[model samples]
Target: MTLDVSEADHQRVSEAIAVAETGTAGEIIAITAQTSDSYHDVGLHYAVAVLFFYLGTVAAWPPLLDWTWALLMGWSAPPSERAMLTLLLGVALAKFLFVLFVMKWMPLRLALTPGATKTRRVRRRAIMLFKAAAERRTEGRTGVLIYLSMGEHRAEIVGDAAITAVTTPETWGEAMAALIADVKDGRPADGIVAAIALIGEVLAHHFPRDAADRNEIPDKLIEL
Candidate 1:
């Protein structure tokens, strides 16, 4: 899935972040990802399911296979055990290829993935990005990461330990809710800016900028 953010939108968000940070010592990082995971395991599980289903069908209706063989060979005789095994293997191979083709369509692959799995992957990715990009990098450890995965329709807000100590998760609820609402409405850039504004307000209230404060992290949004 394409992230709806444009170059203009990136500049706007960067400006918003720069403005937001001026009021506080807190450092904010915004990241958008096309997807958090490939979900290949989900596809593999689907293929395995198809294999089992075909096997069960063959077992339940052995005559169907015999009829297939007869049609192909133009003979009514029942196949030998070896021939029957070969036919089952061929069916399995066909099913595998068919599932591989189906898995190429991302929507179908994602649909086969469990909701819990998607949530776990999104959260894990957000945490990873937070650590790689912003964790403990700020002078006062007042760093926060706002992460969004477009394909997964998931968002996460992660605050550094110092910020987390002073602010409850509820402090971010309004910002996150607004961001998600905008994303669901196909206004991802608007959602991100709104969330940043709200975060800026909270940070300004809790960690107002001091004369010694300096920008420790870049303001531009990160896209993956």
Candidate 2:
């Protein structure tokens, strides 16, 4: 799955960034991703849960195995202990595999992931991307990153050392709120633009532009 940010949307975000940086030496970078992690472990956990549930149900009801055995083998004679155990294992494996197959669909897999897990993964990914793309890259160490994960409907804002030294995470609360509100309304570009403007206001207050200030980062929205 991919974010539906069109070329026009990209241009809008780029312009927002350019305008935002005009008053501050700080560099602002924006990134959007379809998802942060595959959460394959979540899928494995689900498959195991289903497998155990099936086993528990069959254990509590032995006749279920008898009926299944009869339906499969069509035999009047009761199956041996070995046959019953084999049938149980086989059906449990089938159930597990069926669940695994269904979870291969990305939407279902993402939907099944816990909200806390999604939040953590998106934050972690945003941090990693910030470190690689924006952290300490500017002369004043005033770079900032705004990351959004479409699949999880989550966002994170990370600031470089200089910015963080003078401002707390709460400093970006209004910008974050603006971003989430517009994103939830299916206006990602608008959300980003609003966020950039708000962030610019904060940065300008703390790190006003100097006569020699330069654009340390490209003004664009990176799609990942």
Candidate 3:
């Protein structure tokens, strides 16, 4: 998958994160993923559906069965059960392969994937990234990760333990909403900047910067 965020956009978001961090001890990290998961299970589902439909059509239409039998028998030999089963299996395999091929396109694959499954995968990926890149990196455990998965059309905000202790998850709703809106409009950089500003406001309220506070994490947009 191609990245929607460009280098210039990355720089813009990096600047926004820097500006936001200037007023608070909180560390904000923005990340965008082309996709959280391949959703191969969805492709498998389509293949299964195709197999069942092909089999069902053959079973329901006696004329189709007769045609297949004649084709297999060369119009001279009597139709045998073995020949019919072979033809059915071969056709089913071919149809399943065709379905799989069609689902290779990203749009078709995403469309076939369930919304709930996408959401779950996106959230799980966000949490994993927060742990790997943001959590425990801050001196005061005031790190927050803003993650967006483009293919799934999902966004999540994950805060470190210290930040979550003082701020509820609901507090990030506005930032998340703003980010999602901009992302949907194909302005991922704008979304990140907006989300950073909102998150900065919240962090400033709860973890205002001190004279001795130091920047602990890099303020750059990470693309995956």
lDDT of 3 by residue, 18-87 (tens): 9998899999998899899988879988999989998999888857867866776667666677877888
How do the residues 1-224 of candidate 1 rate in per-residue lDDT, one tens digit apiece?
Answer: 56578999999999999999999999999999989999988888888889888889888988878877877777856678998889879978899879978997898887778989999999999999999999989878899999999887789999998899998878899998999898888889999999999999999999999999999999999998
TM-score of 1: 0.92
Off by over 4 Å in 2: none
- The order by descending lDDT is 2, 1, 3
Each candidate: how many clashes?
Answer: 0, 0, 0
Q: Give the whole-model CA lDDT for all candidates, comma-separated.
A: 0.90, 0.93, 0.88
2 versus 3: better TM-score goes to: 2
Structural similarity to truth (TM-score) of each candidate: 0.92, 0.95, 0.91
Best-fitting candidate, measured by TM-score?
2
Best by lDDT: 2
Give the poorly placed runs of model 1, Cα more than 4 Å off.
none
Instruction: Please state the error at residue 32 of candidate 2 in Å.
Output: 0.5
When sorted by TM-score, best at the front, the candidate numbers are: 2, 1, 3
Tens digits of per-residue lDDT, candidate 2, 157-191, equal 99999999999989999999999898888888999
lDDT of 1 at 48: 84
